[model samples]
Target: MKQIINTKFAKNIFLSALALFSTVTIMAQEEDTSSKFSLSGSIDAYYRTTFKDGGDATTATPTSFANQTGFALGMANLIGTYEMGKTGVVVDLVFGPRGTEATFNNDILNGVINQAYAYWNVSDKTTLTVGRFNTWVGYEVIAPAANFNYSVSYLFSNGPFSHLGAKADFALSDDVSLMLAITNPWDTNDISASGTYAVGGQLGVYGQFLNAYYDGGGQGGLGFEIDYTGGFDISEDFFFGINAAYNSNSETDSGFYGAAIYPQFTTSESFAIGLRGEYFAATQDGFDDVPVTALTLTGSFTKENLILKPEIRLDSFGSDNEPFLNSNGEATNSLSSFALAAIYSF
Candidate 1:
């Protein structure tokens, strides 16, 4: 496992350097002075307090964000993009608990490089990308800067995070495109513990008011997952979105499936309110199927490059579900929490 991981790392670095050299050389011959390098990212932090009487309720929340009491650092992310004509590279690095949990699995290399990828435009309509990149599965992104709500949803929490491999993106038309990729096993952020790969991709359609996307893949002996996401601009000030996903692990003989909906309304240039409702379930032998449902209401206020998000969330478990602990340390079926977060982007 260690040898394979080392070799993969070396290969990734080698390919990135080689591609950069070749592309830059080609661009130099063409005398394309349009090449540019840019830097951007965000810094975020939050405070959370559970309404429960008993325990911290951090574990009861069952999702990302506000894991600790009082104040917590969400993350400090830095992304650099370099483009020289048809070739480009993106390097994203992150730190803090939010970054650690979102980008890394286990404790290895936590809060390091979230994604590092190189891309080449093979033609006007096709492009190739290699290295580690974020997954195209869910509607909400890993970055807080790209999300409407400050907290994460159950769907995003349970789905694949990122993949490391090679991918090809094809622009079929003005409003349609296709992506195909073969990547290391799910959530293998830096290395593949299984020493295997999986195939997956996304098919997307973009319209004036509606957009739809689907992505899925299966690992050799691990499992399979498929996710669908859609969004509609109901009006200039209102928007709606939905996400559904299913994943099955053959090794554990268990499966997980869920769906979520998002609705938002902008009342003014500085304030917007959004709501997320989600249902999630886990299936395994000896336990009856009971789904978990959650609803989150978020209000976002923006001032220049700074944004504040105040959110309230309630989660309920089915009658047979006992995943949460009550204030007195008793098994419970429901949990509620509140959080306030701030983000600065440039």
Candidate 2:
């Protein structure tokens, strides 16, 4: 069950984290080597047009790149980090529509922060982190530069985006690692979320040509989700990745599940092309089952710190589901869109 957040308790936690950060900074100041600080981020903008302009692109995929017929701002992201011996802090800030929806339901200070977390090195191979951070699940991320496609997948749209918690990461060996975390109920980017905490973890294995990971977690007041992501380098210029996920909410009797595969080919240092095919389904207590299948093809051309992505996507609804609006404003089972996006990173 969800509980009301205690203002005093939340304030105390924030103050404590601030105090710890200050203490570590002071201690590191006395050391011969001064603490290191870095600032980096990216800016993104895109233009998208749907084949059927009457039906908004936002109706097709509920995440970013939802512009219907013209140009739009994707987001501006800024990340700063401070690190010293055994301790560090990260402050990630984002502004724009994409940033706002990344943590839509929970807003602190009217939606300015993406993540503010502190970390400690417990040992050579162990580390602990506290405060809010991004979720370990999902193949795609909020950052446009990190994704191959301009549009997001349904799995990414519906899955948890970030978490508020404390987590520890351990490197067991050269090829294996693990992470364990206890966080405020799922999707709560705000630190003040109350009620029972959720437990989650990730286990990973890395090999010369292949990498695989499994992550899962749940909140008592909400539900649970499990995800698997794997990738293989088929050749020097070719690669493939697959992802699968399942989530269920006990309180609402609703479930969401999906799978996707991504394939890419890089012919040169300046150009690459990729495709993403996904199928997703949703089931609820009293509503008609909704299922979506989509295919996206994207090409990237890069020079220096700038990259350009041109993409096209097609989507279709399940036979039993209600259709989306077509160009003429008539209900239709399929929709298509074209997008061009540019990103500059530093």
Candidate 3:
């Protein structure tokens, strides 16, 4: 009886051990296949005032964001990301003035959906992405936290903001990469009324990119645009960036061309100063070319996840075109402004 009882006890122990090992192995496999989800975003606001003869706050800079007088809200950006093995998804949402302007072409969710895309890693050197994504043509993005200056430039304001379609990214070599995309016409977020589409390509060598875009020329199509965006680190504390683009519409015989340079100097880990000089021009079939020269100086201070930017900007347009008014409400060809912005990121 003692031998039989001891044998039963041993068998029970062996079964329990097996069960425990199986449970651990299952848990390890689950951990390896589990997906990762993350949330990140930013919020920003600014106070702006003009420095012209009339000190008119109404006639601020003609750019996209931070144009409202006195205190104004920039936007709240929320980005959610999910990653599992070789596949991942990103959903970026935004709210407020800046978001509204950036997504002006979105018909359904007007200012809410900034970017929603899914990507799959096809191989070690290639990836495929589908859905809507931010345009890869510009040096500066729509997010205020991503830009050194509180205000935007003409090139960014007029360029395509986002695209909806499919793209392939290829890593040609350690330093060379290529991207090709086909999408609905520029800024057509929901659907294309004209049933037209666009194609874009980008070649990257080192950190510079040569980007090109073309669409079927029609009433509302963006005919073609070629852009070059790049930056160089001059020293440990100084950096220089450049952006140049030419856009033309064959149907309308109208388009714009512009170039801008950014020079920044970091004083410390928390503070930096930057300058942007731009020359932009517009051409129409019958109208004379209208050109504008703009200069902006900005200082950035950072603490933790919060950033403070104080900026001064000046714009001078051609004498033939007076788009701004002075303190006396008279036509003028120049405008100057000052702004202080606060941005918090997480």
How do the predictions measure up, each by TM-score? 0.85, 0.85, 0.89
Residues 92-149, candidate 1: write the lDDT tens digits.
9888888888775453365588899888787889888888888878878888989988
lDDT of 3 by residue, 90-195 (tens): 9999999999888883544867999998777657898877778999988899999999998999999888989887788999999999999877777887875555
Flag the better candidate by lDDT, 1 or 2.
1
lDDT of 1: 0.76
| CA error at residue 8 for candidate 3, angstroms | 74
TM-score of 2: 0.85
RMSD, every candidate, angstroms: 5.0, 4.6, 15.8
**Best-to-worst ranking by lDDT:** 3, 1, 2
Show where candidate 2 strays beyond 4 Å: 1-33, 53-59, 191-194, 207-221, 286-288
Residue 162 of model 1 has an lDDT of: 78
Report how far residue 272 has shifted in candidate 2, in Å: 0.6
Question: For candidate 2, what is the lDDT?
Answer: 0.75
lDDT (Cα atoms) of all candidates against the true structure: 0.76, 0.75, 0.84
> Which candidate ranks first by lDDT, i.e. highest?
3
